[model samples]
Target: MKAVVNERYGPPDILDIREIATPEPKAGEILIKVHATTVGRTDACALRAHPFFVRPYTGLLRPKRTVLGLDFAGTVKAVGTDVMKFAQGDRVFGLTPGGYGAHAEYVCLPADGTVSAMPSGKRFHEVVVCEGAWYADTYLKKFNLESGHRILIYGASGAIGTSALQLSKIYGAEVTAVVSTSHLDLARRLGADRVVDYTDEDFTKISESFDFVLDAVGKTSFFRCRPLLKPEGVFAATDLGPWWQNVILAIWSSLTGTGRVVFPTPRSNRSFIEFLSARIELGEFRAVIDRKYPLRDIADAYRYVETEQKAGIVVIEVVPEDVC
Candidate 1:
């Protein structure tokens, strides 16, 4: 199996594709021959180990997991003992949040983990989405988002942002998507009740208030969008914010019982994967693909994702779709 190997924490240039031994599944695990994967903000953050806080999970001085891919879509090559849910040749797509290795031709994950069967009639590339939706759903779940509630999604063009927008709609929330000019139409097409072009005007200055305000791309802060939030409204950020203020504010909110700022730490599980798979089958949610790269050119993919300009997911073809 060929995998993207990054032994150190640095730029995308540090990543190299190397031939590595394919993993065999352990009991209660499944071995997947990865056909497609993605390089998104999570992969970029893990690759560089940025923000100085991801160190504890990735590694203190270096990356513990050499292959950085969070989302994977592939076919089950083999199943280990007691894994009755999946069989060889079953198409599967899910996440590898526990120990990411999906940037390769093969990955092994617990059978009962975030792994799930591919939605009926869906291709590997089409369903190669989990990390972004998982994070977005986590934040929404933390906010306890409900129908008829109004919400604003900042940075609505990125992977997490796009997912948040679509999921918010599914929860019956009236969504306002904030993005630059290039993504204005895309946001509206994804079911945003209203689209705000941040370049043309300030979204924070808009007249409407929201039950929730989400910084999906981590580029904004609670203070910057506080006025948009109604009283008792919640502000959630995907990033720690500039100078780690989101985390600090989250702690303060928890201690003070204000419930103002929330920095959700996403937990990967099969339930959400199952939910997303069903949505895909129902044509209720769709991945927003920006670019596709072969496995060998993953370093370039990393560079693109790091730019923070990608419209949505940057896919990696570990195994070509034709082959799959």
Candidate 2:
């Protein structure tokens, strides 16, 4: 099996595709012939070892998990003896969380982990995009967004941002999406009620207040965006920006019970993927793909995602499967 191996933590150039031995399923695991996967900011961050704190988890010196990918959709070629929840030949779409081996043509995940049946009638490539939406869906669920709520999503054109914008609309929230000038239309198309160009205007300078503020890119802190939030509104981030300040603030808010800073960490699983798949199957959700690259060009895909301009998910086609 050929896989993109992260030999060390540095530039995308350090990643290499090599003919590695295929993995076999352990007890209570399933071996998948991965057909499709995605490259996003998470992959880039893990690769670059940004924020520095991740080093202990990813690697102290070098990457512990050499293969770099999180989202994958593929067919089950084999299952371990103790696995009863899934069988061979079941098509699935799932996430690795921090396992980080989805870039390969084959991967082994616990049978009861994030693995789930792929939504019927969806293509491999298209269904794989749902894996990128896991975090957004998790956060929205935590916030319990509902009708009449308003959310200001900064960096609304990226993977998590795109998913957050659409989910906000699905929950009937009035969404204000902030993005670069090039992504204004894309933000609107994703169901943002309004769009702001970050380069031209400061999002925090606006008069409008939101029921919640989500800094999807982690570029800004709760202190920076708090003024834009309603008196009791929530502020959240996907990334732990700048010296773990957000993490610190989130802790303080939890302790004081007087603030609304939250960083949600929902476990990804079969049920979670099924929820996202149900939305896609109903045409209520769709993956906003920015570009597609062949398995051989995965480094380039990482290069593109690292540029920080992608409007949605950047996919890597591993098995040439058509997706919807």
Taking all chains together, each candidate's TM-score versus the true structure is: 0.97, 0.92
Name the TM-score of candidate 2.
Answer: 0.92
lDDT of 1 at 83: 96
lDDT of 2 by residue, 1-324 (tens): 999988788998888888999998989889998999998777888998885888998898888889988889888999998988888888898887565899999999898888778878778877766544778877787778899999999989888899899888888999999999999998888888999999999999999999889988878888889899889899999888778887888899999996698888857666867778788888878888889999998889988988877878888999875542
lDDT of each: 0.90, 0.85
**Which candidate should be chosen as best, given lDDT against the real structure?**
1
Best candidate (score: TM-score): 1
Q: Per-residue alpha-carbon lDDT of model 1 for 59-146, expressed as tens digits?
A: 9998887887889998899999999999999999999856488888899999989988999988889998788899899999999999
Q: What's model 1's lDDT at 260?
A: 98
Residue pairs with backbone atoms closer than 3 Å in model 1 (clashes)? none
